[model samples]
Every structure is written in C-alpha cells, then in structure tokens.
Target: MKFLFIAPRFHNNQYYWVKSLTDHNHEVRFWVWRKEPLENYSALTPSLIPRSSFGLPKILSCYREMKALDPDIVVVRDPRSFLFVFVSMLIARMQKRKVFIYSQTPLYQTMSWVKKITVRLMLRFFGSLWITPIIGDMRYPKFHPRAFYVPFAIEPQAQEKSPVRRPIRIISVGKIYQERKNHLLLLEAFYDSLKKSDIRLTIIGALSGNSPEYFNKMRVYIKKYDLEQTVEIKTNLEHNEVLREYAKHDLFVLPSSNEPLAYSPLEAMGAGLPVICSDTNGFRWYVKDGENGYIFKSEDVSDLKDKVSLAIPRLQEMSKNSLNSVKQFYTPKSFYEKFMEAVQSV
Candidate 1:
C-alpha cells in the first residue's frame, strides 16, 4: 500500500514509523514540516505548506500536493495537525482515498476548553482516529465512533541490550514541562527515599518555554533540602546520545502529573529499563504494579518515595520484566499490523 504520513516534523518517532513501513515493502511517503538536520532520507521532502504560513495559500497548496499523491491512506500524527489533515481529507474524499488520524490524547481531558471545542469541530470531519491502547478511560468514541486505540511503535534498535552501569542511575527523558512533567515531584520523591539509600537521578530533556525560571526554582528547593548531588538537570540531547543515556540508566522515572501517552516510559521499557511512572491513565497501560514496573500517585511525595524505594532493590528483575512487556505488547510488528487492520477495515 502507498502510505502518506503527514506530521509536523520528521523526528525520531516519525522516522522510525516511516522506515518500518517502507522496510515491510510498503511504499511510504511523508509530508512533514521540517527536514531533520542530522539524517538524510531520500524518501521525505519539504511539505507543500510550511507550518508557519497560516492562511488560505498553505491550505490550498497542501490540498493540491495531497491530491497529487493520491495515496491509499494518509495518517495525520496529532490533533494539532488536524487542520492539514482536514484539508487532506477533503482532497482524499474527492479522490475516494481513506484518511486516518493518530491522536495521543483524550480530547476532553487533555486540552483547554477552547481547544476542546476546536478539536470537536475538526473531529467531525476525520474518517478515523488512532490512539495508544494505554489511554485508560478518556472516553474517545464519546462523540466520534471512528476513533480506535493503537499503541506507538518503538524503533527495533531501541530494544537492543546495553551493559548495565552501577551507582544506580535513574533517567527521565522527554520535554521538560513544569507541573505537567512534575520534575520537582520526582526530585522530592527521590531525595526523600535516598535519605539512607544511594541513588542518583538525571533529568534530561529540552526544558519547557519557562524552564529556565522553573529550573532556578527547582535549584532553590534542591539546595534548601540539600539534594544538590541527588538530582542533576540537563537539556535535550541528540537521538543517539539520548539512547546512550537510556542504556546507562538503571531505571526510568516519569513523575508527570498529567500526560497523554507518556512516550518516554515506553522508550525506557523498549531499552530494557524498568520504570516508575505517575498513576495517570496513559502510564497505567503498562506500568502494572509488580508486573513490568510500578506506578505512584501523581504528585504525592510520600507515595512516590515509597515506590521509588521499593523499585531500587528490584531493578534488575523489573528491567527484565519491562523489556518482556514491551516485546509482548508494544512491538513494531504488532503496532503496524493492528493499525493496518483498522485502516483496511475502514
């Protein structure tokens, strides 16, 4: 099948999926906002409409390019990209081609009221919606019957083995969003638990827009509590560098108060590291208490500390279980097969 993946950027996940589909003998093309500076993939080209140009010109150009492709299926990456997806749907509808959307969040729960209203409006036009199976009880089909839950696929290379390092290093990977990611919560929990124990946490990700201010505040808390050596903060690294970080860490910690799908936890599991995540709907999908990893109450310092203490002793066992869980549940083949079944069923 000829597939056109329309996304904002050709980053790690986008590149992984497009490459996976193509390797499976499917003709895959991309309509993306920017070309990744580091890698060269001849299959992808500049999107017809730059994401910056917000007007009728962008819409018509995207529509024309999509129509020209005449793809069998066009998958839009997220709800924010729905405008372009809407245009693709219009053109695809005229050509009788199928349109699908990949949504990672619950509409009513995650977005602001205004954004929710807009999402509902655009959702009415989409043929189908895809989300991760772990999205606990967000009530996806409350309005649109076409919505389905399909987990994201990790790169095959992400599943490889890495030599374990000592000193019990814990890493958190993803965008650093205050209140949302709850990095402060992670630090507090880790600090409290390590009063007698020995463990270190590395906060690695691109800080949010207000991260500099947040980081300064966190530093105050760290110094006041004397957790300077307990927690370290850093920004985003290159893809391979992040992977190397993953390989070194003994466990993955995501103390997010509110997350839609929580991609970092999945990637951590894929890399054979156990996880301790917030008890949010998305993280609950895989972090089954004693199964793969453990879950803690969101923003509850005591609860998080207890879980972290429990996790440290069983790192090796939990890491193996986490890898097993990803292999059994979140494999690339499973992701593509289930998604393809849903697409073809439409």
Candidate 2:
C-alpha cells in the first residue's frame, strides 16, 4: 500500500508508525508544513501560502503533491489542514482512494455552535474516516461508522532493574505552565504530604515562550516554601536527556487538567516508573487505577496528596506492573498490528 500523510510538523511518535508501515512493505511519504528535517522518513516540507494571502497557493501545493504521490490512503493530522484535506478528498474521490483524519483535538459540549457546525460539515462531507486515540473522543455526534480508535504507541526501551532510591524521586514532565498542567497543585500536594519525608521533587519541561509569568510564579512558590533544596526545576533538555532523567527518577506524576492524551506518563511507564496522574488525561484509559498506577481527581490537591502518599510505598510493585502494561498495550509492535487491521477494514 502507498500511504501519504499530511501533518503540521514532525513528531517523535510518528517515527514508530512510519517505520512500522515501511517494515510491512508499505511505501509511506510525509508532507509536513513545518520546514524541518525528519530523521528516517521520506518527508517533504512544502511552501505554505500565508493566511493573509487567501491560501490558494497552499491548496495548489497540496493538490499537486496528492496527484504526484497517488497514494492508496491519505492521512491528515491537523484540523488546520482542512483546506488540504478537502482538496485531497476531491482528488481521492475521483481516483477512488481513501483518506483518514487523525483527530487529537479535545471536543467538549461547551464548544461554540459555529465550530461544532464546521466540524460536522467537515466529517459529514469531506472526511473519509476519523481516527482518534481515545475511545471517549469517538462519542462525538455524527461520528459513528467512520470513527476508529487506535492507542498511541512508543518504542519500548530496555529498562534497568535498579533498587528504588531512599529519598523517593518524583518527576513531572510537561510545559511549565500552571493553567494547563496545574504544576502549582502538584507543588502544594508535595509540600502538604511529602515535604518532611525522604522524598524529592523534580519538575522537567520547557518554559512556554509566550508565558514567562507562569514560570516566574513557579519559581516564587518554590522560594516561598523554602523548597529550593528538596525540589529541582530543569528546563529545555533534549529528548534523550529527558528519557535519561526519567530513568533517574523513582516515580512520575502528571497533574495536568484537561489534557487530550499525554505521552510523558507512557514514556515513564516504558522507563519502568510507576505513574500517578490526573483522571482527565485520555491516556488514563491504560491506567488500571492501583494496579499499574494511580489516578487522582483533576485539580484536587487533597486527593492528589492522598494518592501520592499511597503510591510512594508501593513503587516497586507498581513499577513492575507499569512495565507489563506497556508491553501488553502501548508498544510500537502492537500499534502497527492495530493500524494494519484498521487499514484492512477500511
């Protein structure tokens, strides 16, 4: 099968899918809007028409690429690529090809009517298939029959069998923003429960370019609580370095509120660390609450503190369960199998 993907940018997760498809003898090409190099995939960066210019050149470029590739399947990954997807759908219809849309955006009942109508029209008339990472996302109105769920996959690493540290190392990885990630809540919970205990906290993430205020707020909170000695805040580490940091930690905590599906916890699990995250994340689908990890109420510092306190003692058992869970459900090989099944069904 010949597959072409239209994506906003290159992501680490996409590498597994591309490699799997190629391994299965499928010719895959990626058209990315961002002018960045992808390590091993056959990816191209096409010139995009600025929105101020009415987007005709962008549509033309996409159409030309679609005609040239002539793929059996076209996967669209960004909602902002609707114009490109619409053009591809038209060409696919004439050539009897299939197109699939990868939706990671969180849809909620509080969305504007205009946005809802636009989504309905896109799925109803233009989209050939809808692929979502979470099952709950497939419950949108007018999404049956075409919607399919596929779990996100990561490359499994050889985890080191190390004894749990005495001063428990807890780590959280995400953008250092309080609104989306609720890092302050985690800080509060850590202070309330584990400050006096033999536990240390490490917050790792890139500071948002637009929001230095939130980053400053985190620094102030750390200073106010005199946690400078017990807590560490590291920013802007390379991907491999981040993974190494995960290995150094004993447990992972994700206190994010309103996340679509976070990859950090999955990476943590792959690194053989037990996870304690908010129940709001879509990836909680794999968390068997108290089996592999624990899930606390979103934004509830008290509940988070209780969950963290309970999980600290059971780290070794939970760590084993976490490894087994990733092997059973979140591996790249399993993802490829499920993706192939979905393609055959379509």
**Could you report the Cα RMSD, in angstroms, for every candidate shown?**
4.3, 4.0
Q: Per-residue CA lDDT of candidate 1, range 182-216, in tens?
A: 87777777775545556777887766554477767
Over 4 Å off in model 1, which ranges?
33-48, 51-57, 78-82, 105-146, 155-166, 208-211
TM-score of 2: 0.84
What lDDT tens digits, residue by residue, belong to model 2 across residues 1-346? 9988766655655766777778878888876645432223332223332232554425555566667778989787745455654555565666666778787644322447786676667666666666766655324543445666676776666764388978889999988855688888888989954558888899998775677898888899999988988889998776677878988898999999888788788889988888888888876776879987899999898899888878888999888888888888878788888777778877
Candidate 2 yields a Cα-based lDDT of: 0.74
Model 2 stretches with alpha carbons more than 4 Å out? 35-57, 78-95, 105-124, 137-143
Query: How does model 1 score by TM-score?
Result: 0.81
lDDT of 1 at 292: 70
**Candidate 1 worst ten-residue window by lDDT:** 135-144
